[model samples]
Target: MDATTLALLIGAGLVGGACNAVAGGGTFFTFPALLAAGVPPVAANATSAISIWPGHATSLFGYREELRRHAGRLKSAAPAFVLGSLIGAWLLSVTGNGLFRQLIPWLLLAATVLFAIGPRLRSWIAPTGSGTLPKPVIFLIDLLVAIYGGYFGAGLGILLMAVLTLIGLSDVNEANAVKNALATIVSSLAVAVFIVTGIIAWGPGAAVLAGAVAGGYLGARFARWINPRILRAIIIAVGLGLSWIYF
Candidate 1:
């Protein structure tokens, strides 16, 4: 890769990692950067997937305390995520990306809308009470969400948070912690599949991996110091900007 492409990869990774640490959607940034750098669409997606794994790991590690507290819940969700991820990865490897290419813009648009109106949705759902959602319901939700993550993974975090809220996580931080852990598992599994298939481009992936690690660490540290409302606003703004460009 040329110097410019290398720079773009690192810069995209840093920004994407920060966004992921805060709200989750770093793929939006890195994927476009890869595409702009002249990588093919499928290769870019696979490369972006490989690159973000470290950031996901870092973010999950940063939430270790929360993960410890929620071990049982996380365990309950893991099997579903793993199963879904394998299926999704297999599907991607076999089917090619024709369908996903057409679906991406609409998926991004919907994800953006959900994110922008997330607070309102939370308010609307609050009165219904989460006590009614059984464990089976939660598992089902996680399974479906993981399938989506395994397939594309752009806004998986947002989708996870929304599902977790429905199942009774009132604290956004706690929900975020779970989201990160589950996302790590799903993405890791998907990346493994892609790597085995030789679908990943190593050059851009390595650069992004370096930047994402640093950015994830910084973002996690900053998360402890920042107000979540402001963080949410920033995430929404970034998501909107990406949607405008990509959609």
Candidate 2:
């Protein structure tokens, strides 16, 4: 990679990581940066997943208590999540670049919409005093979310959070805890497939990874000072702009 490409990738990663920590929607930055850096569409998607994987791990660690409290739900959710993720990852490995390119704009727009409406969707879909969804229905919904996460994953957290809310997690922190844990599982399984399929662009992925680690640390230290709503608005704007550009 040229110096310019390297710089772009690292810069995007840094911004993406900070956005993720402060709000959520890091992929809106990192995925576009990879595409602009000249990575092929499928490879860029896979590389972006790899680049953001570590952040999920750290987020999961921060939610250890919530995870423990929801241990039964987590246990029940794991099998479906793993299966869906593997299937989605394998599908990506087989997809041609041309096809993936054609799909990119739509996928981005959908993710953006999902991110934008996430909080409202959670409230509307899982209103207070609503009964919990049946186990099978929850499994099906989670499986679909896992598949999407494995495939592109820009708004995976929002989707996961919505699901957690649907399943009776009214507490924001508790929902976030399960969301982070499930996201880690989705990314880990998808990344393993991407690695085995040799689809990742390691050089650029490494750049993003290093920058994300640094940015995550920085974002954490300054999180209390940051207005998350402002950060979230910025991410929503970026996602909309990128979606329009790709379209």
lDDT of 1 by residue, 186-224 (tens): 889999888898888887789888899888767766676
**Highest-TM-score candidate:** 1
Show model 1 residue runs off by greater than 4 Å.
115-128
Scored by Cα lDDT, where does model 1 land? 0.77
In lDDT terms, how accurate is model 2? 0.75
Question: lDDT by residue for model 2 over 1-247, one digit each (tens)?
Answer: 9999889889988877755554456787898899898888889989999998877676555556777999998899999899999988998999888887687667667666766676567566657646466688888988888888888767676556546655667555565567667877999999999999999999899999877766654544454454656544654675676678767
> Which run of 10 residues does model 1 get worst, by summed lDDT?
125-134
Pairs of residues clashing in candidate 2: none
In order, the Cα lDDT scores of the candidates are: 0.77, 0.75
- Model 2 weakest lDDT span, ten residues long: 217-226
Q: Pick by lDDT: which candidate is best?
A: 1
Going through the candidates in the order shown, the clash numbers are 0, 0
